[model samples]
Target: MDEFNGTEINFHCMYIPFCDARDCDRELYDSPVDCPDCNRGMVALHFTILILMAIFITMGNLGIILVIKRNKIFHNSFNMFKCSLAFADLLVGVLVVPSGAYETASIMMRSFDPTALNRTDYLIGKDVAMIRPDSMCDRIYQEDIGGPGMFLSMISVLSVMASIFHLVLLSIDRFLAVWCPIKYNQRKALKDKCAISMIIFVWLVSITLSVVIPMSLGQRHFIHGLSPAMIFTLKTSNPSTGIFYATFGLGLPYLALLGLNTATGSIILIKHRNLVRRSSLSPSLNSGGRRKDEVKATITILVMIVVFTLSTLPAMVAVTFYNGTEHKKKGDATIRSIIYSTLILLLVSNSAWNFIIYSWRNDNFRKALKNLFTRKQQRQRAIIRWKQLKCSVLLLSEEKRRRKKLIKLTEASNSYSSEKM
Candidate 1:
């Protein structure tokens, strides 16, 4: 049995490229080396994916923001929350996605020694080093201007957290409006101030979580020694921190959103059922339009909640379990990388695609967006009409002057002929 165990261990060691324990140490392999062709392809693919995602996110969020800003109909408290969410998503697209893509592309294109271990490999095991030198990492770290990478990392986290909080606020607003109509109407008087206050509070908390805590914890883990992807996973460096973040930062908010949305959905359904029964009993009291609006609003809220849950839950789970998993084998490492990238992409898509959801489910928002475009077209047409009218007036005046001049000349000629005769 002992001989068999020794043979199995030897076979495993033979398959590992650098099975020597000392070769895995960080200090020993600080030189740069060229990446394999497969890694290069992965880098290019991921970069293209991220760039496309950024473009979509930017355009979608910009449309949402512009629609809300231009249309007074969207100036209410609920829409304010939506606007806030859109703004956060816009930041993610502009700052986070591009920064990540650039870093990935740069890392892939550069030649490096294949002995240095990046942050992820270092975290998993000292034995797993990238087949690249540390010089590339050093060069990237030096190129950072006033820690732009760190700033982008914090902004990305901040925006995503803010979006989730804004969604929670929106759900609460809808719940109150539906469940307690009288109270909600009364509170509507203070809606503007309250909305502003809530938005400020969300930003404050987001900053504390994304910027303040991470900065205090030591930025080196993210800014100096880590890959762009690893920066977002900073919580996993320590088990306690990961638990704390998972429990408070993500898990609690997710549960709260789930509970609030569920309650809202239940209330809306019951109200709808009651309305249906009333309509059946008194056919004359037709509230079809109002009832339809309510149903549409309910569906929109439900769809938003479902999308948010689907996009964010996997990332939360991955963050929670990342430290506990074993990623020693190359296959396991590759799988882990793919999973992480997919989850991040999903989260980004959630931010990017909310505009589509709004346009699809909410008639009012769709109308508002349509009206914005329609108004622009109308204004252009009005300008052209005005110019055409001005040109016509000038031509008419010129014609009148020429006709008068001809009449005067004819009169003078007639007088001259009469005098001659």
Candidate 2:
């Protein structure tokens, strides 16, 4: 059976250079034909948008990293959350962006030559590509597909999970800092480090589930008969898959952050409000700027929550509802293009907007940024002044020497005249 299947698999793979099989039957399928309009304009659009996103995200996240690393003032508990969020976004760009680009390219490439895709072979000949879940033949042949699509999808999922998990930690940190001030002040650094470690653990666990388990042993699919001839496509589907992801990656963390942010942030706001009321009513009137700083911090934290939610929720919604739509095979390009553009914009924006949100909304962050830029400007001005001074000094010294030389020449000429006389 192995020898016969191996011969059959080679025949199927002959058309697809990238196809390989580990646990799939190869003899039952034929080579697929090209997909005329599968990826079409969408692939180009996806690539363009992805490339631009990669560039924009890289630059923006780097700015956030620099701001945190370079400035001590931006290293507070809440600001630390901002930095961690930025770092997570940066990791997404670093680890997942290229794979996203590749996935887009692969879909586009397969559209052009669907039958020639080696990834398509595992998809077509085996039980991998079909969307149906009940067939025992499909059920029994679960371990057949392995390729870049699966790998990239796994990493992308991992990045998303990390982003969500870190956001939760960030929200919790802000919550604690606001609602539990005494505790926050006492053990801020140790708590922050521990939170960071927990974030790392989140990523480690997420990667294990998202990437490692599925690749090691999961059912894969191959799309058949989408083109002029039989064509292969790769995918995976399980009833529990979406639920599992939603529960662990999306649903749980989202609720955790939202609940904590709302509860703790509100408590802080109310307490501070009462304090302000008392201060305003007091006879001494020496409360200074305490109320104002407190109010500003509250507003800043609120804005952070709002911005984070707005930037990320849309993509999550899209992901959640992705399996619901019954898109046509022919319209794959259009659908993917639209979805990809929107999703990438949202995801990338989450990373890109943190700096502006933090700087504009939080007084501490704003002041830190102002001081940084001011110092930079002052240094530049000092350099310019030094350069001007050096040039002026050189010019004046040269002029003095010229005057001395002329005087000596005049004396020499006088001496020569006297000798002649």
Candidate 3:
């Protein structure tokens, strides 16, 4: 299924990877042609990673969101970036996983029937209404999946960019807050940041390509390749713009994020060590709890950046090498196949690894997990307290009412006795 952008014109593509044994392997070849064993392994590996990505990214991000929402201590400007990064990845996992899985299925089905795409569409009720000569089951796969796959890639690119930018901002925020707390706390200075505006701008720029690029293609269902549906086409000497975007959007920003965080975090940690050493002389330094928190946050961001970089770097390098001018000359097909397979693994793993970093490195994250699980205990305690208060209030009200009633009765009886006398 797919939809256009809303009032702001956000476009979306939903796809599932459904390549069969031959095409999967053949994708890495000089031309999209034959290769059986490589294709099957590729397909199997993609599907397997898709399942793991769905589970890990989704659950991990959900945990982060839960922690951020629940823990007041964790709720700060810097944490907002982490929340956004996790959220974007979470969404990417949700959108991409099924599409990837479907793509794998589409590929597999392709071997049995050339018209496998149309046949898949028929099962999903996505037929073009114009009958095509495909097996009914595969119609949706043809019309919907491929084009949507490209669009999904575009969206994923945007999400990744947003996540990176957010991380960068987070690092900056921490740097300011730690190094210059007074300035950071000032209303005027803090207000100047306007993170919300930055967020909007980032998303707008990111979302712009999906909506506007189609204008070049002239609002077609999908392009067969890079051919724009409309009149305009961008000719570039660089052969692999799409691949470049995919790699750079994820890779370069992460590299920058990692560097910026490392430099800033090291400075903060050094300062913290100094503060700790001089803890005896300065009463102010005694409240070094904030420094500790800063260290923990820094470590978490640094670890996340490292893990994301290492996990995804190989694929970026592989794609760059594969798309290089010498690729055709240097390739044993076997080596090329190996590179593509490795790239796929990296790409799949990239979407899933952040959660693992949090679980392993972040004490706050672990505490948040504990809080999430033990929420029922907290609720039970609250309920018990409420019940006791309610009971005490009821008893006090009953005693007061009884006293009033007795007083009224006695007054009435005394008045009657006086009249009779």
Q: Which candidate is the best by TM-score?
A: 1
Tens digits of per-residue lDDT, candidate 2, 295-401, equal 56656655755776787667556444443123334245344535534654575566666667666766655665565568785697689999999999999999999
Q: Is candidate 2 or 3 superior in TM-score?
A: 3
Q: Rate the local accuracy (lDDT) of all candidates.
A: 0.63, 0.52, 0.54
Candidate 3 residue 158 Cα shift, in angstroms, is 2.1
For model 1, the superposed segments whose C-alpha errors exceed 4 Å read 1-34, 39-42, 111-146, 182-190, 219-233, 276-287, 323-332, 370-421
Worst 10 residues of 3 by lDDT: 225-234
List candidate 2 segments past 4 Å from native: 1-46, 102-147, 186-193, 220-236, 276-314, 320-326, 329-341, 363-421
Ranking by lDDT: 1, 3, 2
Residue-wise C-alpha lDDT for candidate 1, range 310-354, written one tens digit per residue = 987786576444431245566655566566657767876877768
**CA RMSD, predictions in order:** 10.4, 11.4, 10.2
* Candidate 1: 10-residue stretch with minimal lDDT: 6-15
**Shift in Å, residue 127, candidate 1:** 6.2
